[model samples]
Target: MVNKLPLSGETVIFTSTKKSEEPYELVRQLGGNPVSYPLIRTEERVSVNDDERMMQTRNYDWLIFTSQSAVAAFHHKLKRFKMDVQDYELRVAAVGEKTAHALERIGFRVDFIPDVFSADVFVRQFNPEGESLRALFIKGNLAGTLISTELSLSVDEWTVYETLPEVSSAARIVELVKDTTSVTVLFASPSAVTVFTEHVAPKIGWAGYTIGAIGHITKRALHRMGAPVHVMPETYTLPELVQTLAGSKGRN
Candidate 1:
């Protein structure tokens, strides 16, 4: 006899960007009804000195990426200027495995990935000797300054993408949250949590559903807004999140 899927007959909601197909597919494979209700969208940010900034990447010893979106936006800038990734001899540091994979896809060798995927752990564990290092942080506009502030090295930040709330999905999100049955809502970023709090929480309130955050920062964000986090994986990756949720189904 075949074993039943872990998430059989459950509904899983994805609240990040619509481009997140991996986790969505994982949930589907686990026999959950996956829904793509993106609560945040990202757009590449352009500046008058973008060309010059792209050229200046060679000055840094390391390129730090915290998210796949940052890596994608950086790659886009490189292609726009007809620049090759090999032209810069900068080493790479990524906060998560997915971010490192994104860097590798663009021909970058990731030199560092902290044991934990959060920025606070990254800062604590990275460069423990307090060695002077020059790094450029490729991030979205909404990213916090924890890395720049806490790291012992000189860090320059490049805003390659801007995350905006996906207001259009509010109606759909309202409908989903209204149903309390076997529904698990997953949040990958604090920004997504903020969007949900501002737009959806007032309408439906944080009841009749299971909430999951991708990392401690996002979990903290949910707590700040008076929402309980039902599931959070030890490793802050999309695949891990989905797997953890699937495993939790048995416990619930």
Candidate 2:
């Protein structure tokens, strides 16, 4: 027999620029209302410097992808620059399963995925040796220097995309979230957390809301911003995050 869904009458607010199907569908399956309040918007970075940096990817030994958006933006740039994916003899390293899957969907094989889905863990486990291990990180504008700072390898980065706060104003975001009685705010990255804390937290505190994070890194971001985390999945995936939140105490 099929099991009954727990989030039958609950509401979940997800913060992401692009539309994601898994979490939204899961909320509907569990009979919960899914609200997409995208607080972060990502766009490609176009410049002569960006183009020149992208052309230099072939010289790097490893290409590091931090997010799915980076993978998509990178592929889009590749076609625009007329660079064949196969022409770059570089191994791929992804920070999380979703990033790896995004690369796989585009026919790129990910050679390395850290045990933990965090940049700190990824860099520690990278184990770069010798001077020949040149690394290139394709990341967004809001990415921290932690990965490049921690990695022992000679690393260069290209800002393939930039993340902007999308709510327009704090008053607008506060108005959107004020009516959510049984609210659960889902965060996918540190950037989203930053955007929320800077834009929304001041207007409406986390008084009657629960916070859900995709991974420990995001959970830490919530903690750093003084937001309480009510649910965090063991695995950093949208499906797992939704399932965990559905099973949270008092959420039903």
* Top-lDDT candidate index: 1
Q: Give the root-mean-square deviation of each candidate in angstroms.
A: 1.8, 2.3
lDDT per residue for candidate 1 within 1-252, as digits (tens), equals 343588888898888886657887888898988888888999999999999999888898888899999999999998999999888886889999988998899999999999999999999987833367788999999999998888888999999999998988877888876764788889999999988999989998897888888999999999999999988999998779888888888665
TM-score, candidate number 1: 0.95
lDDT of 2 by residue, 74-175 (tens): 989888878877787778999988899899887788999998888888878987557768898889998889877888888887888888888664455577
Q: What is candidate 2's local distance difference test score?
A: 0.82
Model 1, residue 92: distance off in Å is 0.8
User: What Cα-based lDDT does every candidate model obtain?
Assistant: 0.88, 0.82
**Candidate 2 vs. true structure, TM-score:** 0.91
- How far out, in Å, is residue 237 in model 2? 1.6
TM values, all candidates:
0.95, 0.91
**Candidate 2, poorest ten consecutive residues by summed lDDT:** 167-176
